[model samples]
Target: MLLLFAVIALILNEAVAWSPTNSYAPGNVSCADDVNLVREASGLSANETAWLKKRDAYTKDALKSFLDRATENFTNSSFVDALWNSGKTPKLGVGCSGGGYRAMLSGAGMLSALDNRTSGADKHGLGGVLQSATYLAGLSGGNWLVGSLAWNNWTSVQDVIDNRGQDDELWDISNSILNPGGINIFSSASRWDQISDAVEAKQHAGFNTSLTDIWGRALSYNFFPTLYRGGEAYTWSTLRDADVFKNAEMPFPISVADGRYPGTEIIDLNSTLFEFNPFEMGSWDPSLNAFTDVKYLGTNVTNGTPVAKGQCVAGFDNTGFIMGTSSTLFNQFLLQLNTTSLSSFLKGIVEDFLDDLSDEYDDIAIYNPNPFRDTEFVASNYSHSVVDSSNLFLVDGGEDGENIPFVPLLQEDRDLDVIFALDNSADTEDYWPAGLSLIATYERQFGPQGKDFAFPYVPDVDTFVQHGLNSKPTFFGCEASNMTDLTRTPPLIVYMPNNRQSYNSNTSTFKMSYDSAQRMQMFQNGFEAVTRNNLTDDSGFAGCVACAIMKRKQESLNMTLPSECTQCFQDYCWDGKTASSSANVSTLGPASGSVSFVTDSATSTSSSSKKNGEPQMPQSHSMSWYVVFTTVLGVALGIM
Candidate 1:
């Protein structure tokens, strides 16, 4: 009993009480002393360029494995040999869109299809592609998914998918973000008390506190359960410590965020897009194109160097804080301040917290001693707002309308040959994506900020819906000649928007809660959509994916297209078609059994929390789980 309580006590460290100077504070922070402290984000950071060498070490085997399965029909033995001998195989990138939990779970399903570890994926479905890919970029809700996978030491999506509903599993969203305390874990009071105190610690340590901090902490709980040390100290740069990642065994993870000049116009395609990777966090966009070393954040830097030599800060890139920055849409949780079950004293702290922050900028994440302040004198396109301000500002990546996070992949530095764009944006009234993100990305190329980058042309939303381009898989930038210009040509895009095939994955962008059963249906629908229902629905799906991967590389080598590649292009490529009419659909559901999941309830945002004002985990579980939970809980609480 004592031993059990001891473990429970440690797991519940924050469950009862927590008070520290905030590991994110300057003096108390933990520093990382490897790689350059900072540099101009004129292109990819030197650390990232070096890390690419390590990543290629893993990609060699992965590309070979995937090509062995994908290139069976194509008999270009010498071309394959050239690719292997010269190490010039195609570079692949995957981008996931933003749509809260809907995006996270749905994207996970698609990732599982690409992941060879999934049961029978290599034999009966599309797999090995994720391993072959070099970059995995995500935004908003997608950030939650990608960040969780990397933070957990690169666990497979199938592992997270298969573990749904288990209290200890990575994503236990049965409990809403507002309230993460569940029965199998700690009590509701314990969880909220911890979150409340953590926020206070940041403020007490002399940093600006916002709803993003609280939202990030709660998100960490859902993704990294108590068994994973509750992830309080898990910084994004700590990804360097993961042997799998260090060895280039997993794809590099990039979480996307957008810069917003407070009190300026809302974000648009012109807004600077930023990314958080293990090595650095900055933008390739001309808007303030500079990157500070991820580990050395929170330092007083000027002109990309520390203002005070040898004096730098760390821990500000806390995993939750970075993820929260990308998805600040969750900052709306402050509106639910009256809904939590915190004590009157704690509740007062939240009220004062709101009073201290400007309502207009509550959604923006703060980077104090703004790393780029006054760097415009030496940097290119450093916006005045970024130069004059003492802090850096950021908002949700989706706010700029490029919800799919394709910008980072489109950079010339990456030079990716192909991209699997898994767009789960709620871009339509029915919550289905209508290819708006793609169009926005294409339009940005003509803008002043887009001169350095190249992109494939895309049609409007109406064109997408009318031609069924948004309904299933569609190919963009297929014709190299048409896409080429003075700059480098962009990669072929395999656009896979979320569609209702086997199940309804279209949950509202604002919908906050989902029970285990509903969550599973979303995952299954996404998995099938990508794999063409595990090759049963569309047998040629795997070959088509493989063909897309090899298209640019084959063309570069002046090789002939196989019959399979030719047929795939004819069937799926857009082919300069135009549609003048709009095709509107109410809901793409066979209704998923009356679709009560859409109705307003305590689990949704239209209302407050339940009677206790906390989103508790569902009680639907095997009696055995409850029995063990009760036995364990009774001992921990001294009620055995």
Candidate 2:
């Protein structure tokens, strides 16, 4: 072991010296406003609207295949035929929540169950849902799932899992980010140096770099699978050219973050939420009330106008940087460096980096040359507060408890028929979701900031647990007619909260790593949560999903609902009842045991360690090292 360690150390030292330097790649630019997708206050972008038309056509075909297989044994094909013949297509959006790797893998598992491409998923699966959907949104760790898939041309979650190597590089926990994963084949020194160099390059380019820059760069090795540590030249807009995305063969991906400044408290419903899509970056909130072309984000734009008539910046929206922006929460991961058992040399590197962060400097994504600066295009009261600032800082989307990325899906123009919200939030002590994200969104629809939007009624979080709503799949907005007082009809919401049936998948949000076995267990538990252990109940879970998708459309067409759908609504819809107290509320309760996975074959695994209890970490840390590291690194990184 000593010899192995020394050899690895030497290789790392040599690799660091040879770390690659990244260069800026210019994006296609035009003088026209539409070229940059300059935000219009009226509605959805022309680009998005245009893309949706193509996406709708694609969804129709994908849905035809999915519904045909999903309802194979049904007595009639009239429903499928009607959808095909009718010009109107059902619109679907998936919203995933934030919970570090726990949320990412759980979201993947749910998507796996819905994916038609997964082996053996056709019969009982909500197959083709992803391909049929027009929009997919993710927040925090969930962004990692969306970013990775988008960056990889919409690769299926199974493909990601299948690509795991002998060292378990796909989701390897043994190789810490500080130490660097072996998948890169870079020694520890090389890994650290390469990441440092990448961030330094961005800094040298006159952009402010923070811990998030470093964190995002590190995450690319595991999530992006590119040759460069940061995938430097890759921009989020590049997805527009990928065959799957350009051809509308897959869902449009959106990543979300919240507008937050240092030391400011954000209310759950009022935060000015921002979204990053292929075409642009902006908010639906009245605050900024505009979007700048994502590719030109680093350009000096004031009051919705660029610094020069013919000049706009490029290379600012690096894929890793954008992913890092949505998930700024994990910047805290760097602060936990001393807790790990890393060597003093490595621990000192991380500690020195983090030591410079002042309390207010923590958990922020520093966007210098703020794109919305000096803007008088005030659509809301809060516009003035952010528009005048030279720096636009953002934090985790879930900081205000709206963990699920649902804002973009609620746009009036999207006219979605149904939204499948995958709640992997760790709201409860045991880390299981408690539906707080949905509640926050629901409450926001009626608030001043979200007055124009509509959301299905969701009960309080207490009611969520009291009625066991958080433990199983439940539907909201089953009857839109009943909400006639609202501004518009809201999509039916199918809420699937993470839970334990065969495995305790509620790993802590702070957990930095997991072995492949534990990782698979989390995925399996998520699959079971969504599919009810893949049981076939007379056409099974897919039938229920189909019912949810068809419910709004059927009602719009004035058609009588099918009996299967009626039964599904009754079984899965919230009854609007609230208990006097949640005292007897059942939960997965306290999770115990880190479920161990033993791989038997390429596609097979067995669970062996059923020991009950969350993994415990030692707390004998001497605070001296951590204090010194934080102060030094924070200053050195210019984060202070």
Candidate 3:
């Protein structure tokens, strides 16, 4: 009886193992069940409950859409084959017990395709969808539990449906199946805990914690439905190994100072922390270096004796035109100078000029003399180098020598008319804008009223096309010339009188002349007015006092007088004759002439007529003289 019972027991055990019921029976709890337990324990609020309800509805709709798509594309034969083949080995595919497992696997594949399409459409919207799904899955643990039970019987079928979604249970269960080692459900708290731990570890190590890490861990543990769905993993390891990131992070040495400090630092000052040393040292001290030599205090020290506050030998003016002084301390020093002594000096000059001009003139004209001309035309030389220096007339060369000079032309009339032309040629773009900006600044600063003279030609075709009317008297047009071109048709020849006085010369000939002493006085006055003018800051004026002064010198040769006037104007004028007279005589004839008489005289004085009218040719006269001389000599010899 005992032997029979043992045999029966063995047969029963074998039958149970072979039966499909045992293989597919619910053994492990699912991710969905886990989430339900969490929700129940947490207790959802009214708003949370409503959100959950909506999320569930969306999840059902999405799942149904996935199912419909899957059914349409499904082949039961293919699923059966995949399942049967996969069952023979732990290979990839649906299993032979093709019921819920086959259906779920096919459904998962369909969902995956849908998710891909949706995610690609809009990442944010997909994220919202996933979030909603996760919430719904968490709420409905029963669905996930059932799915998990079905999944165990045919793991291959489970693998197909796994994808990234908000439904914690579905995602977790899918992730498990995709990964194979982790828990079977998407809503498992243990999986989240593991992810949180990994994040904490990265944070502790000073590594950047990103969402990618969480997804990677989840995928590793079979929490994600589709193994490749989350996107490529990005971690510190990847960044450190990649060519681009490695190059970006690589250390490079940079120089801090000139020969005074012969050292290099690994950190780039532009990117990393850098500071200028308040203390000064005359020579390079390698021993005092920190980064290159010894890991000393945060600061670098000099081995040589410390430099006294102001006793350090100064470098020659190695200042760049745009970059300014080299030493980091120089700007601070300049700021201090501007605040104290320089401010006072400027203030005094301005006060003196305003005081001088207050009674004599209502408003002062800020003139920029064109350096290219004989007269100091204040409007032209505003930003030239010669006028920017301390020697205003640029008179270092010596008296009677060509020295670039800046002289201010004072106008009694506050209302001014300005002809502004911008050279729009490729090379002139930079210089032209600077010049125009300066002019605009000047006009705003000194003159309350001004009108720009119009030019007929535009230097740039593009500008002409855009602006239409070429004669429009605004900041427009440019032309290449031997020297700077003036825009006015007749050339702006406004006779600015110091006081109301009638001159005998013609309108064009009546030039405004200021003596050396008078010019100096006016320059001093103008300088003061510019430095002190409240209008300097208003109306978009950049307060370029130095530039304004330079312009004045370039415009007027008068400024060079008593200094470089004679030499500067020598080329401009012939034998001290003004340019106007010389040009008039050479090209336009005398100031006054009758057209009929001039034309007749020109016709009468033709070269052909003059030659024809000659009494005898020079060659004929020379030949006759030679013959006569020879004959005379022969006669004299015969007589002798």
Output the number of the lDDT-best candidate.
Answer: 1
- Candidate with the larger TM-score of 1 and 2: 1
Q: Please list all clashing residue pairs in model 1, or write none if there are none.
A: none
What are the Cα lDDT values of the candidates? 0.71, 0.69, 0.20
lDDT of 2 by residue, 1-640 (tens): 9999789755653442211122433333445552333555568888888888788788888877877776655555477677656666678999988878888888888888878788666755566887778889988888888888777768887876686665424555544554554345347556666666656667666777776776777787777553344465567777777788877888889999888643453424566788999988888787777787776777777676776766666767878778888777667556655434444444554565555542444456887788878766666456466777888887777766678888889988778889999989876657788777776677777666687678877775656776899898899889887778778889999999998878888875655566677778887777778886775433456777787888888888877644666777888888766544343211212222232111000010011111132111111111233443564344333232
Instruction: Give TM-scores for every candidate, taking all chains together and pairing residue i with residue i.
Output: 0.84, 0.83, 0.12
lDDT, residue 71, model 2? 60
Give the residue spans of candidate 2 off by over 4 A. Answer: 1-37, 75-77, 166-169, 181-186, 261-267, 338-357, 380-382, 536-539, 581-640
**Any idea what lDDT model 2 has?**
0.69
Ordered list by TM-score, greatest first: 1, 2, 3
249: Cα error in model 2, Å: 0.9
The candidate with the higher lDDT, 2 or 3, is: 2
lDDT of 1 at 34: 34
